[model samples]
Target: MRFLVIFLLIAKIYADDHELHSKHHIYKELSHLDLTKEQQHRVKKILKIYRKELKEYKELEEDIEDKRKDIFLQKSFDLEKINSLNQQLDREAHGIENRFLQKMHFVLTPQQRKKFVHYFDDWEVE
Candidate 1:
């Protein structure tokens, strides 16, 4: 019974670690680039900034959702407000994505960029 308990605990730990790695699969793909120490450091900083921006984006999305619900709850529909929110969403999405790509482009070598682009084929903005 003790042996079985320990085995289950170990399996649980492994599963948790696997879930974390899967959530940030970018790190796994970046590992294949074989970055130099300086490149890795720079990339880590870039990712930190990217993550902060993403968090803000997510908050904006949630706020927009709340506003949309409020709009519907009102007796009159606000089509203009709905359109404005959509445009803001589009602008924020494109701006964050383009900036991240540009920063990564500057940090990576041509060969690394080639490989990185392939990994992005399956990548999602969210």
Candidate 2:
């Protein structure tokens, strides 16, 4: 069950990363919404912070990747360590993503939120 949860979380992260190739991809999506200047500024700020958080997390990701490689390469398999790393990555990734989403949800108007939510069919930010 725990492994399944970890698998799902990893899959979700991969899907999200695939969809969001760049911050500009999000900006392009928002362009269709007709956001006001202030809303645009707030969204941009939110994205900037999100990017910074992701950048900081990258080092941790690399460390985890190295650990994963070691686990696979070593004679002894470390299921426990792999699970721990998965949980940590899941928690941090979700934390960063949720913070960005919460900020975006708060910044947009109800109508804008509706449009944005619908535009990305998977996002249930409401």
Candidate 3:
């Protein structure tokens, strides 16, 4: 059904988000940037804050998976509720990313920031 497709899409998006959000993973990404000691400290601080915020997201993502399974397994369901939850989840996810980027950019110097553009680009999964 159409609802099932939408649910699967939401699940897929969150799964991708979780994969991209690995705490140790970003450290590997920054290893090539040749960061200074201070830069490394700032990055670790930012990552710690981001990880703290992510705890709530993990619970919400789990809830999403559960709701998605419910939709597939249950005969009676409210499509409107599912759509609303999806929108809410999307907003929360984007908000966290936006905040993280802003703080991350604030931490980097202008020169370091120049390299950040390229680093961010290459961070995309193929």
What TM-scores do the predictions have? 0.73, 0.69, 0.62
RMSD of every prediction: 10.1, 8.8, 9.3
By lDDT, the candidates rank as 1, 2, 3
lDDT of 3 by residue, 5-113 (tens): 4333333333444544443344455655667667766776675655555656667877987887788687888788788778877887677667877887887778777
Error of 2 at 124 (Å): 12
Q: Give candidate 3's whole-model lDDT.
A: 0.62
Which lDDT values do the candidates have, in the order given? Answer: 0.68, 0.66, 0.62
- How would you encode candidate 2's per-residue C-alpha lDDT over 16-80 as one tens digit per residue? 54434433444555676777767766776676666567656666778998999999899999899
Of candidates 2 and 1, the better by lDDT: 1
Give every collision pair in model 3.
none
User: Candidate order by TM-score, highest to lowest?
Assistant: 1, 2, 3
